[model samples]
Target: MASPLIGITTMNALRHDGLAAVSLLRRYVIALTEAGATPVLIPSAMPDDGVDALLTRLDGVLFSGGGDIAPEYFGGAPHPRIGGVDPERDALELALLRRVVEDGVPFLGICRGCQLVNVGFGGTLYTHIADQHPGALKHDYYPDSPRDLLVHEVRLKEGSRLAEIVGVEVFRVNSLHHQGIERLGDGLEAVAYAPDGLVEAVEVPGHPFGMAVQWHPEWLTAHATARALFRAFVEAARGSD
Candidate 1:
């Protein structure tokens, strides 16, 4: 059988030369590829019809980590720390996410992707966790920190699909985001949580494989759990085909 084709979202970015571009980190590609799936980058500028056409061909969709989502979409309050807000990316991702969920396409989200899943489903975010979530741990371990550095423990809910795929009840994960889910989305369940009590993972009940995590598992694929997560997603996508 042919490897499943997975559509991954890209963010709006500026090249060093000051030109506009749609970019995605190669690690996401590497993660999906190593898991035996064909990864395709879906830019934010694609029109509704284009996205619709792409969805029909994709076996799975992966929303990657990037900038903070705009506050307007989810009726969130603005914060000084809010940066990298892309209107186009927000519109594209939310629309794409709703479609994928409605279509029952196997999908996985990471970091900002997790937040997107929340906001896409009428839920809100903390905007800035430190200020909004009292006593929140330092979750933004990026730039200076190694991508694979495990910063905190996330306890998985027993019997959750994530726990089943990871084969463990609790594990350390690399933290790389400032915002987090403040309210659980409709039809979504929190399947894991950080030591600080912030939601760390969520899954859509009744969906074939709808899940999202607040960590960078793609960078931590050296561990069996991370690899297993990606493999399970790819296998789910394969089954869909």
Candidate 2:
């Protein structure tokens, strides 16, 4: 059987010398490839029609983490703490997500990708989670330590698709985002949560294979649960071929 072709979204970035570039963390590619999938980088600025055309050839779609989605996309008022918003990337990914859903392509969204999936499906987010939800754990850990540090534990819902895939009711994950889902999108169900009750994972019921996690499993490849998540995703993608 041919290896599944997984489309991974790239971040729009400018180099120090001011040249434009499409960027994606190597960890994402490594995780997918190691799990038996061919990873393809999808530029964030591709035209809507272009993305639709590309989707025809992909076996799965992976939405990787990056900048925050624009507040306007979710009908929320802009907060002072909201990070840089990439309208082009947001537009492209939102359109791409719709096509993926319509076509029933396997999807795995991580971090910002998780939040975008929620917003793409008409959900709202806490612009600044800590400020809006007092007593919530500090989630933004990008500058403080190594990416592999296990920062907090998320309790998986009993019998959830995530729990089955990871084979655990509770597990530790790295925290590195400031925004979080406030209202889940229609047709989506939260399958994991932190002790403070913030959503940690979600899945779209009735979809072939659609799941999103607030943590970056790509960086946690050594963990059995993390590896299982990727393996399950690749297997689902492979089945689509």
Say which candidate scores most in TM-score: 1
Clashes of each: 0, 0
The best candidate by lDDT is 1
Cα lDDT tens digits, model 1, 1-241, are 6899999999888899999998999999999999999999999998659878998899999999999999998888889999999999988999899899989999999999999999988899999999999889999988889999999999999999999999999999999998999988888999999988999999999999999999999999999989999999999999998
Which tens-of-lDDT digit does each residue in 104-155 have in candidate 2? 9999999999999999889999998988876899899887888888999999
**RMSD of each candidate?**
0.8, 1.0
- Model 1 segments beyond 4 Å from truth? none
Clashes of 1: 0
Model 2: which residue pairs collide?
none
Question: Once model 1 is optimally superposed onto the true structure by TM-score, how far is the C-alpha of residue 54 displaced, in angstroms?
Answer: 0.6
